[model samples]
Target: MTVNVLVPSSLSREAEDKREATRKLGYVARAATIFRADRLIVYPDRDGETGRFDDGFVSTVLRYAATPPYLRNEAWGMRDELEYVGVLPPLRAVSQTGSESNGSGSTRQGIVTEVGPEGRVRVNCGLQHPISLNTPPSMEVAEGERVTVRISSRRPVRAKLVDGPLPGLSVERTDLSTALGREDAGVCIASSRHGAELTVGRLETLAGRVDRDGMTVAFGAPERGLPEILGIEASDVVAAYDAADVDDRVDVEPTDLGFDLWLNTVPNQGSKVVRTEEALFATLAPLSLQE
Candidate 1:
């Protein structure tokens, strides 16, 4: 099943400086990678965004964090591609294709540019040239689709389209409504302190839905929770999210947009507040659990 995690553009709004902001975003990226999220979307929270946090800074840092160390220079060589300058931890992505055999080959994320006759497809696998590779008889690919291509050799361009996960998570910057409305967005969940407390039984049921239809989990920015970001009061959020019951979609419209569920992933907290990164791990832990 596909899993998408959403973080607000003001994710680092609570940071005191750029160094702290970059560090905070690094943890967010780590959480997404650890959860095996297919996509990490940066939704706009313009009103809640602080002056220190730039509009596209969050996405830029995340994109940088997701890139492999070796490929970062090649993929993000341009000056504009580099955003935050703080040190970032390495995200050693686990390749779906088995481990490299003596370093002769490596897995690379690619985009399909053209699907030609006789199962030949042109793919841009970060190489100097977009190479044409043959697809497996059972596999079907379309132009403009992102894919994982295993390149055994670069000189002669020997590669094949393999069935596996992308080397690293992909990043996207978009608005909340637009992201949730995507065709593959599946079940969209909003996490907030004012939402219903997630119990064991409720989590088990939710996990089933996530496995079946895939899932998109959205997180709020620092200090400002989703309720505030969406211009909904905390009291109304509690009433709307809780009273909506266990229906596939929450009927009460807390904000202009709708979500399948508004969940309080952290229930009885000793601390008065739970940070976004903490919430991400706490929320995804039970939700991503296997039966």
Candidate 2:
């Protein structure tokens, strides 16, 4: 008999041991439903068995559901007993393509000849440089240099050229950029209070992942987009329902992200405030899943 095992989802993505282990559990059917298990307000079995698990012997067990933090529901919420998923990716910039024959195709390649803070770049291309052409960087060029550029065509009089300025032929400019170093870098914001502080920075990841725009930050632990990282819901923490309390995600924004966390009940009573710049690492230091 293949008995169905309904594991608590609160620890699914939180505790590392459970995250991987839960993923391995092949659920025949998966979903959350409110039922009666020991009169507990948990996502019990189809029969509302919240605790009584009977394989051979009867025993009591806790059940947690997968409620994302951002989800809004009364009760059915927890502070720290949450499961986690991977971090979300950054948003990509939208762009279009067009060419004389149709599209720029793969016929364009550029080197960063010059650049500025706001993603402005002066590039040298393979548009037949050092020939009867135009260079945008306004720098000196050598003969027979490989360059290509988007030329201005009007009056049916096409001006054919490489890329660099000829002995005397002048060129035009375009706002087109070659490469924007990293949009996920140099973003700075902070939130603080009394003496505790936290700051969120938009920077590059070692794996070359872009998180500038979609990069979430927090002042308090729960603010760093905890609902996104942890599968805890507002409904979980409310006494009207039953759920375990959980911790805040490390990178959450500590402002008014909302929570019944230890902080909210303790040092951070009745406050949805924000401000920061102190030993953030100290507050976030001991929070590792190493144990």
Candidate 3:
């Protein structure tokens, strides 16, 4: 199933400095990686953005974080937003063969270094050297584009460019409504403390639905919850959830954000506020369970 994870551009609003902000986004990346999210979308929250770290900074760091370590230097040469990228945590996502394999071979993320004659391209995919591969008959690729390479063996470096989804996370920037309206956006959920408390019974039902339909989960900024970011009242979210509990068919028109559910993954908390990164772990831990 496709799992899409969305976070606001102002996710680092509570961070004190660039280092702290970069570090904070690291955990967000970590959460997505751990949960095997297909996409990491950064939705705009201009009003909540603060300091020098805006949407561009957030997207840049996230994209950089998602890049494989070996290709990072060539993928993103030098950028102002990555000045403090040293503080970002290592994702160590499974990008190569060994534990993870596909069919007869293994799929890995690769960057096209050069496009040669006869529809062949040289790709750098963490191999000893860049390997020349023929582009798939139906696919067209250009230099600097990222592609997936299926490797059958590494001793002689036998690999081929295949039209397949890249392993690990992919970063993109878009508005919230557009993300929620995507065809693969399954059961869209908005995370908020003021929403319905996720009970065991509710989780079981939610899990089943998510497993069948896939899911697109959206999160807010550090201090700004979904209600504030979406320009809705917290009470309205609570009321919508309460109404849904009574009747599952009840449409949550009060929020008008198009989310199927406004969920409080962490019901009772000891802290006054839960950081967005922390909330990711708490929320995804249960939602990503396999049946």
Model 3: per-residue Cα lDDT over 1-291, one tens digit each:
889999999998888889999999999999999898999999999999986789999999999999888789999998889898888888888664346643358888899999999998999998889999999899999889999988888776789988978877989999999999999988888888988888776777777677877889999987889899989888888777765562343233323557888899898998999999999999888988856
- Candidate 2 Cα errors over 4 Å, as ranges: 1-131, 134-137, 143-148, 154-291
Best-to-worst order by lDDT is: 3, 1, 2
- Expressed as tens digits, the lDDT of each residue in 1-291 for candidate 2 is 001111212212221353442332211011111111111111111221222221111111122122111111222233332232222111110111234322332222233344443333343442333113343444444332323344344333233333442211111111111111123211112122322212232111200121222211122221322232224453332321112112233232222222212121123535463211121222222211121
Clashes of each: 0, 45, 0
Scored by lDDT, the top model is 3
Estimate TM-scores for all models: 0.77, 0.17, 0.93
Prediction 3 TM-score vs. true: 0.93
The list of candidate 3 runs beyond 4 A from truth reads 96-98, 101-104, 246-255
Candidate 1 CA-lDDT value: 0.76
Mind giving the per-residue lDDT tens digits that candidate 1 earns over 1-291?
888899898888888877778887888888887888989999898887887676677788788888655445545656542555446656666642235511356777777778899989888766678888888876778886667777787667678888776667889998888888877777778888778888876776676667777888999987889888888788877667665555444232333347877888888888998888889998888889865
Candidate 3 at 208: error in angstroms?
A: 0.8
Question: Which candidate do you rate higher for lDDT, 2 or 3?
Answer: 3
In model 1, what lDDT does residue 248 have?
48
